[model samples]
Target chain A: MKIAVLGSGNGGCAVAADFALKGHDVYLFDFEEFNENINAIMKNGGIFVDGDFVGFAEIKYAGHDIEKVITGADLIMVVRPAFGTKLFAEAAKGYIQKGQKIVICPGSCGGSLIFKKGLGLELEDESIIVSETSTLPYACRVIAAGKVHIYIKLLGGIYLAAIPSRLTENVLIDLKEVYPGIVPAKNVLQTTLQNGNPVIHPAVTLLNAALVEREKGDFYFYEEGVTPSVGRLMEAVDKERIEIGKKLEIEIIPNPVLGLIQGYMQESNYDTGYSKGRGFKGIKAQSKLDNRYMNEDVGYGLVFMSELGKQIEVETPIMDSIINIASVIMGKEYREMKSRTPETLGLSSYTVDELINVL
Target chain B: MKIAVLGSGNGGCAVAADFALKGHDVYLFDFEEFNENINAIMKNGGIFVDGDFVGFAEIKYAGHDIEKVITGADLIMVVRPAFGTKLFAEAAKGYIQKGQKIVICPGSCGGSLIFKKGLGLELEDESIIVSETSTLPYACRVIAAGKVHIYIKLLGGIYLAAIPSRLTENVLIDLKEVYPGIVPAKNVLQTTLQNGNPVIHPAVTLLNAALVEREKGDFYFYEEGVTPSVGRLMEAVDKERIEIGKKLEIEIIPNPVLGLIQGYMQESNYDTGYSKGRGFKGIKAQSKLDNRYMNEDVGYGLVFMSELGKQIEVETPIMDSIINIASVIMGKEYREMKSRTPETLGLSSYTVDELINVL
Candidate 1:
């Protein structure tokens, strides 16, 4: 199958290389501002894959032209941070063809909804299918410009759902070719709530804001940062998220349980599960508070959950609290920013039943 | 002058010794559960003073008997943590005589009001003058039972106020003898708003919750635990506190400016003012999340400010956020606990003007 990957960062490079290595035609593209990795990949002719999937896979195309990348693609994957979703979607709007599929790998809370709106399409438009995954399929990184490292390929426990409930299976069938563990979710809400980065990242980062700035995040984030108090905070956020899911009639798995299933943890408890988790053994925290942990997770992810809770009448005091503190730490009012709130997703007046029916 | 110092902890011992050294008859009292320090003082017949003030000071009495401690005392200084204000007030209720002045050394947000309520006295009842100070005059600690170390006796910038406002001068006159830097406040609200612990303690502690747990608070709290982001959080809380004070027609000095005026900081910026503050130089953080930094500061201080903001129609989102997160970290609902709030202090129904009139 011909595939178009619309980001050349860590996840984008890994996704592009993984499919290219599987003998599929892969075209990688990024914004011109991020041409460092694109230029390197063009010169090298492909991305270097290491660890779980080791090889140098050749790409059909790598450049700044979105038209060349997505015109004849069988599948399009938008792999960018949550904040970049709208930018990428807007960039691809004029070129998006009918019946084409675009999946945001690891939709950080309602990424599909945001992407659909950014593409100037109604959420219920059936001419094109837009979907999102619960999480990225690989714990990977771009070691250098065109060199990528795949720590793990995420053997199981990834959920995918289209914007419209009826079309989730169609997207899952296409995604399963690359991710055998990809499962169809009830709707995009399930995929959004099931993504636990919002539940864990902001809580851990806000609680460790000073430590990260002081030590320049020299300490292992999961091992030393996930103390009992920090775990309790994550639990508080996770409880609010699960409550929001219950209000929406979506059964969301707790973060620790999901961590265990995803092979990220050996235990199913918040504290020791992450602290002693085999997968998170050596991940260091970001050296500053302005990183994606608080900005993307709190601004986009938690703000989305908190607004959804407000619409559905499920109290999310903990999520709101984390958003408030994170906003202060980042010197921005995240709640007021409306980066990915219900209103921003064009669901401000959405009734619980209406939301359930639509999504 | 005859002085009774309630709570034989650090502040209590320091106050008792300071007055005794000035030739006033000092009597120290505490609950029997904390008879260790009381018993030590009883055995030694005095408290050993060190640091800024170095000398042996005689105490008129030291025991757990409240009647003996309060009877015939011209002035009573309640120097316990904010949580103990009510307990100590209830203990001194039966022995509190007319015309005697009782002052909570640092009214951790409406301490005088809680103390008066705990004494079963109507706020307007002026039989005994109930007063409070903006903060403790000395940054001192009890090195051991019957031994106290005075790090620095503050030379200026302490505000004192009485319940009726008119009688503030009377308490100020007596307190000024020991706390020469003390000045009169507009009301108890001024004293409450001027206290900076709620602005600094919980913000810094919550931001460093995991580090405190992992390191057992081995680092210098102010110098190391405080960073740019932590200072920003503190500044946010301080802004909310000042807004609450403004709604009540009380002019509150910003925390960093107050810290400079009180000699706790050489610089007047929140970030480095705390990180490099000469007065805060070697103070260590609490070894656990369950310490008074959160309990006394958040439960009593931030909660009171938040509740006051609610009653006065002033927004305190940051204060409320810190209270919510601290409640989760401590596993207690601080807002619902009513440990200290406008309702608990009998100011819940007051309008802004009425609240200003009362305080």
Candidate 2:
């Protein structure tokens, strides 16, 4: 199997290394401005992996050229934050060949829809398969140049869904080799609703905003930041997500069970689970309020979810609140921009059933 | 001159003591459950003042009996949180006599309007004059029963407005004796729009949620909690407020200037004022998120402001966001209850101009 990773950030590096270690030819690509990691990988001729996944894995290609990276690749994975999807989509649209699969790892929120729109591809187009997962498979980071640390490789929580819905199985066949635990979703909407990042990141970051600003990333994000009151806010957001999922007829896992499966906590409810959860004990808070937690998760993820609620006529007051707060803190007009919305995706005219069938 | 001060908490005690010190016959009143302070004052034959104003000022009457408290009072002051306005109104309804003036100290947001609704009285009634001030005259707290520590007595900040705009001057003349700095506003809407507590408390409390939970009221709230990011959120809410005021043709002071006038901060902008302000240095953060900051400010103050924006067809995203977050944290459905809204005040049927004229 040949794979191309269209980002050189921590998620991109981890995904590329895992595939290479599994005996697949992996090509890592990034824009020149973010080419430092790929440049180090090129210099070392491989990626250094530590923690859960150990040893070095050789990559066949590492560069800024998108065409060279994806040449003859069987699968291409976009592993950047949701905000970076449009850029990758623009970069890949001209180079992508027929039958090549593009899977967005942790679409964060509505990644596949936004990416497909960026490519100007129709849902019925069968030349290429586009799919998205609920979240990234590994909680990993780049420790240093050419070196990555794998905290926990997700086991049973990740879900994948393809554009046009029917193509989900085709994308899953090849992806299963790299991510054996990955399962097919009913549709992209199902995958998006299962995205717990939108439920967790923004609320936790916002509720702990002062601490984050004061300590400058010195506090344990989950252990010290998420108090009982903070956890309830996240739960309220999760309830809205669950209601939206129900309205769409998707069998969405409630956030606590999903959190447990995704390695966030030992318990199955918000109050006890978030406060006592050891899975997220030592993670440092973001030093700034404008990080990916608010930018991607709230701006992209919650904005899309809240808009979907609007389309389905399901009230999402909590989700809307998170987006509004994120906009103020980040100094962005998210509501006015109608960001990642059904209207932006050109799906505003479709009924919920139509949207599901189209996906 | 006899003055009736309802709801004997810290503010009530302080205001009652201030009037008594000025040689007015003060009748301090509260429910029996909260009579501890008044009972101690009665035992001491007056209130024990400390800090700026020191001495025991005699009170003619101090009890939970509403009828006895207002029997011969020249003025009535409601000094409780905005949430308590209804209880006070209900208690004083039949007991209230024509020509007897009632004023809400720190009306917070729409205090006069909500109180009017609770009394089932129209602005045109003219039987009684109802007015409100932007904030309390002094920043004081009860060190113990009958003992209040006065921090600062506002010099030239408070603004008062009556329900019927024409009645403002008459209400202010008597109020000016006790509150020497009191100035007549254009209307109650102007006073409500000038409210700075609603603009400050909820946003700062929410942004510093974790710190408040962990520190448990140990931190100096304004100096430590109002980071640049948190200040920006309040500014965003303030922008919505200013825009709403403009739509209604009210001369609303921006929150920073209003904060300086009300003595919350020294500077006139959020970034510099909140960080460098000497006025807010020693105020402690609430020990829990369920305090009056969220309950009163967000529930009554921001809720009314946002609903006013809705009625005027102006956008109040930040205000709405704060209310939504507060609802989730406090486990209440604020929007559904239409908490302290224009409709609740029976002004929903009126046009913006009509509502303005009625005020």
Candidate 3:
């Protein structure tokens, strides 16, 4: 099998290296501006994996050329921050071959729809299958250039859904050899709504905006930042997300329950679940408010959910409030930015029945 | 002139002691449940003053009897947290003399209206003048039982308005001897909308909820809590407040500018103005989220502003957001609580014109 990973960041390198070590032909690519990691991979001729998956994995090619990376690959993984989804989609416009599969690792609130629209493909088009997973399968990061560390390879609880729901199983079948625990979701909405970064990150970040700016996030994020009030906020946001899913006729797992299933939590509640979770034991908050927690999670994730709620007539007061507060803190109009919304995802005109039909 | 100061809390003790020092006959009263300070004042025969105003001021009366304090008082000052306004109003219901002048010191968003309604008096009742001040005249606290410490006497920027607009000047004339800088406002709406606590306290407290809970507020609140992002949230809420004022044809001063005029700030910008303000130099945050910052500020201040905005068709999204976020943090629905809303104040059915006319 052949795999092309479309980012050189932590998640991208982890996916590419883990699969390459399993004897798959892998190619790594990032934009020319992010050539540091790509250059390091080229110099090392491979990526070194540690922790959960150990050993060196050889890469067949490493470069900045999107065409060279996407030409004839059987599987293409778009693994990066939510903000980069459209940019990568645009870069892969004319190079995508028919019958190829593209998966947005951890669709941060409608990544598949944004990527599909960015590639100038209609939602119903089936020439190529574009799917998204509810979350990335590994707790990992790039320890150094050309070196990736995997903290925990998720044993289960990853949901994948392709555009035009009928083709979801076919795409899952292609990657089942590496990710046997992945399961099919109801549709792309399930994958998009089930991702919990937007539910947790923005609330914690907004409530702690002052501390992050003052102390540069000196405290342990999960242990100290997720206090009772912070946890209540996350529960409010998660409830809204689940409500939106129910309105769409999908059963979206609660974040804490999902956390328990994914091996990230020792408790089954929002407050102590993440604070005492072994999977997030030592993770510190971002050093600043301009990090992806606000930019991508609130900008792309909450904005999209709020807009969808508006379309479906579900009152998402908490979600809308978080977005408004975050926008003021960041000095950016996230709603107007339209980073990801029903309108941006080409679902603005679709009714509930039509949306269910399409997704 | 005779003056009765209700509430033995920080503001009440300061008001009572300052007036007694000015050769006025001042009586201090509090509920029997809060008799520690009252008993101490009775034992000492007065309140010992320090800081901005230094003296031993004799109190003619100190007890929990509402009639004993309100019997023949020329001026009645309700000085307490917003939550206590109605409770005190209930206590003074039958005891308020016909010719007495009642003022809610620092009307925390429609305190006058709430007091007026609680006293079972019509808005147009002219036998008694019911008014409210935009802010208390001093930044002081109770350092010990029967001892009050004054920080600043507020030489300017205190606004006073009566329920019946024509009586505002009469109340001002009575208060002129002690509060020489007090000015007549357009109405109680101006006074209610102009109080800066709702705009500043909840924003700071909500953003620092985790810190307040974890450290029990061991840091300088304004210096460390009012970072750029926290200041931005306050500015956003302030903008909504000023807009509500504008919709009612009142010119609400921006909080930073008001802070400058009230001698609380050394600068005129939101970010550094309060953080580096001379008046707020060493004031620490409340020791818990359940303090008056959340209860009085959000429950009364922002909720009132938001409900008024809804009545007048002015958008207060930021104010609503802060109220919603604060409600989640405190585990109470502030909006539904209706601590001080247009409806709770008896203005729910009034049109904007009718509201302006009655106020």
Best by TM-score: 3
Better of 1 and 3 by TM-score: 3
Off by over 4 Å in 1: A93-99, A117-124, B117-122
How would you encode candidate 1's per-residue C-alpha lDDT over A1-359 as one tens digit per residue? 99999999989999999999989999999999999889999999998889877999999899999999999788999999998999999899899899899899978878898899899999879889999999998888788999998877886789999989799888888877789988888898899889999988888887888989988889888999999988999999999999999988999999999887888888999999999987787778887778888888888889899988988899998888888888888889988888888888788898989888988
Interface RMSD of 3: 0.7
lDDT computed for candidate 2? 0.84
Pairs of colliding residues, candidate 2: A164-A359, A165-A359
Residues forming the 10-long window of minimal summed lDDT in candidate 2 chain B: B274-283
Candidate 3 local lDDT, residue B85: 88
DockQ of 2: 0.69
DockQ of each: 0.82, 0.69, 0.81
Report the number of clashing residue pairs per model: 0, 2, 0
Deviation from native of the Cα of residue B341 in model 1, angstroms? 2.3
Model 2 TM-score, all chains together: 0.90
Estimate TM-scores for all models.
0.94, 0.90, 0.96
Candidate 2 residue spans exceeding 4 A from truth: A65-68, A93-99, A110-123, A336-339, A343-349, B52-69, B89-100, B108-130, B163-167, B311-315, B343-349
Q: Predictions ranked by DockQ, top down?
A: 1, 3, 2
Tens-digit lDDT track of model 2 for B163-194: 88798888888887778878888888888778
Worst 10-residue lDDT window, candidate 2 chain A: A274-283
- Evaluate model 3 with DockQ and give the value: 0.81
